[model samples]
Target: MDTRDTACPPTDSAPVQPKDFIRLIVEEDNRTGRWDGRVHTRFPPEPNGYLHLGHAKSICLNFGLAREYGGKCNLRFDDTNPLKESDEYVQSIQRDVTWMGFNWDGMYYASDYFEQLYQFAEQLILKGKAYVDSQTAEEIRTARGTLTEPGVNSPWRDRSVEENLDLFRRMRAGEFPDGAHVLRAKIDMAHPNIVMRDPTMYRIRHTPHHRTGNAWCIYPLYDYTHCISDSLEGITHSLCTLEFENNRALYDWVLDELDAYHPQQTEFARLNLTYTVLSKRRLIQLVEEGHVDGWDDPRLPTLSGVRRRGVPAAALRSFCEKIGLARCDNMVDIALLDHCIREELNATAPRAMAVLKPLKVTITNYPEEQVEWFDFPWHPEKPEMGTRPLPFSRTLWIEQDDFREDAPRKWFRLAPGKEVRLRYAYYITCTEVVKDDAGNVVELKCTYDPETKGGWSKDGRKVKGTLHWLSAAHAKTAEARLYDRLFLEENPMDKKRHGKEFLECLNPESLHILPSIFIEPALAEAAPGFVCQFERLAYFCVDTRHSAPGAPVFNRTATLKDSWAKTERAGLAGEG
Candidate 1:
């Protein structure tokens, strides 16, 4: 479990007429005294897998509305499908919602209302509103007509109420095999909306549920279980994504038939983020087939994945606010999300130095056995964050990419005979470059000026470049996992648009691991979930999943900015 404690950063106060349509509805409902001015919403997630980024938008909206209005929101698991659900997924959902910084007024499960939901189904049957269907699952799908056609009614649609009751009871008694029969609402066969064409309410499954162990053999479908559970809890508003717009009619049909308390089912467009896939089926395939690591892989879009990648809860909330709510679905640029993360981390994370690719530099003029300590501020702009002691010595490690043997006119970094300021230490001039047998730059020999003690000269001499380095003898070795976007295309899920399967569009270079790296000794003791900036590099966090007492693994959350964006601005060709 993550040890970081967080709160849902407070949203700005609501206005006279709210900007978004959903808020507008809530405002009008309050003014009209709907449900006696009580506002209640619920986040009902199916516990078949872990929550992903798409679900974050819904979680924020549902819980945020209740919070702003001083109402209540419930965290309910729609665990109707026992075959794919498990306790692991249920626990993960709870942890994620909490990590996102919101607590539920009440926690619940669809299984808790099984008896009441079953009774409601019987009530509909007694009123000639639903019946038992004997068709196979495929046959039922075939009969459910398309946009231009009418569906063929099931032969068992008109079964006597007494007979249907007996069959349904038998289903609960474990008298039928899986897929033997399904209980469906007897809606119009010729309805224009295909979802209303006699949808299934319950199906027989002999599998034991994670919660309600083998005492029964039947399970209710999601569409049927969701609305009834909301009504039973007296929810005033049932918020769902736009994909459920067509299902709204059926949601109302079930409650209206039972004469139960009905919550208005409002649908808004779901978040469609770029450069990754969020569909449950695709995510499951990615995990099950070993296309990625686990559910919490930083490259994945799952909330656990992003959290492990060092995305703060406050930044996610801010991103949600910037995007707001929309009636129509559109792709949101992932860059906006990166911007929010950078904004939050830059203000809070302390500054540190790390070398992903180390190249040794021996200061020829400095005493080999001597060591000095330099005072480095934790943050340049935030003086209150204070300072830490960093060791300076004769031998140190700098980034391999920082030095160029044949430097360009625009390059200010290290090169043969080039002088550069060592950050927080002294000025060094590279006099020699040593190469390995393969002609790779192995080491650099440099000389430091005694007068330039604190990275500056007593005389008014200026250096164009400054480089970050760590004392070779004092620095601790650790691993750095550099992570990037998981997909190459903006809309990876659009198979036709990409001319390949979604999996084929996956980014092969999403993750590059540097097995060994050097960081200042203080960073080795950083607690899991601690975030900081690697000066001149990127924003990183001590991985909560891998770091322990003395071992730390850092995950790069984002570069100073996208590498390409920086390259375009600098008008340079290679790494500097």
Candidate 2:
């Protein structure tokens, strides 16, 4: 039995709520008895690079649709180009999809159907539908004319079917060197859609495929391979991004001419995120040029990058659902993505205290050997999560930014002679600030109000500022990496219009590593990928790659402030 025959029903038991346009189309298809009320979709990603946030949208749509309609979604790798494709990328893509809480009904690769694809090319030639073109790539491009002008036919277009067949077989049998000849469809050169103007069906590439090895010297192009793969896999709804809208004509033409099982191709706008570059070519450039550490650099929009940056897979799925499907393209605010992460983390993440820039504070009146343990709730509103023991001692570590010698008008944080409530502890009044030879504030001398236990004053006198602190004796030293937008401009590629390279727009302050940050002792044994919120700081996760036993390295996920929420509030206020 086919493994794909075993269908896993949708996890949600609620009645189908067809909200998006894509879902609505599926609904209508089911209503009209299209393909006998069966729905099958596939996420066919080319394994040239790691999957990105943009790919997440397609994955959700395809798998979500399959689940919603009681069908199956196949995970297929469009591994046509061996030059840039690799098994490492294939594994990464699979890991990403699985991490996003999905399992493919069937797994396949375009290379798996190489023999069939070659035979199909011969079938096209026998029907006078395809021919071998000896023209160089540039010659073909020049002949393929502008959008307004019709393309000119290749001089080799009139090759007999026997000659075309022999060349195509030889091309596949490793007889021809790379780029010596290509198989082009014998479609109308004067076609309105430039993509249909005799598109190249196959090309000779001597590079060994990660899966197929050097068994074949020639490979079918994506335009030629994708449609056939879908048909062979019995895909009912072929969903892809709008960039392939032009190519859909060729998709249909090839299958129609060959009398193959043609699936309906639908196009939706691909995700274009603000403060991000999703183009695979640009992403490759970023990786090769060392703009990022690798494909998984937290600054990049790649799925592995975001995953490493501590973004929950659930948050990514929620973002995709919220963005929905649209026919036209638009730039989605990265803040919106951040909003989703913050929302999910705020509710689920355990709270701990971490001081990124530590400033020492000594409680002069407190006994040096005396230690008090206070129970602090993991989440203020979630008592079910219980609490962790927080140690309070004579000395504590506070955020350097929390202290201001020359305070602003509205500054309520620590200042000389000011009283502030330590989170879940007593109120403390700063007596004096100690500085080093360089005159930098090194330590603060403070006296705690013994009566103000549990951050509440018995006399009902309230302190204006509340600050987070860690007991110096019990705190664990850690490395905290803070990440910001990778690109300085909202549209990094837009710099090209202004005669500046996109690299020029790379943000210099994208990553900041503080090696000696202090966190609660409870976080010392935190395993890699463990996510938590640092009180008054940011949501963070143990770095999977760098964090180790006893010493944990944390990556700043997102800030507490929701810029997207603020934007929505401001828009509402403006309307009012």
Considering every candidate listed, which one attains the maximal lDDT?
2
TM-score computed on alpha carbons, candidate 2: 0.95
The lDDT values for all models are 0.90, 0.91
**What would the TM-score be for candidate 1 when compared with the true structure?**
0.94
Question: Clashing pairs in model 2?
Answer: none
Model 2 agreement with the true structure over 1-576: per-residue lDDT tens digits: 011111234568865433667777788899999889899999999999999999999999999899988999999999999999999999999999999999999999999899999889889999999999999999999999998999999999999989999988888788888889999999899999999899999999988889988787888999999999999999999999999999999999999998999999999989998888999999999999887999888889999999998999999999998787888888888888999999899989999988999999999999999999999999999999999899999999999999999888788999998999998899999999999999999999999999999999999998789999999999999999999999888887886555668888888999999999998989999999999999888999999999889889999999999979898899889999
How well does each candidate superpose onto the true structure, as a TM-score?
A: 0.94, 0.95
- Model 1 score (lDDT): 0.90
RMSD values for the candidates in order, in angstroms, are 5.4, 4.9
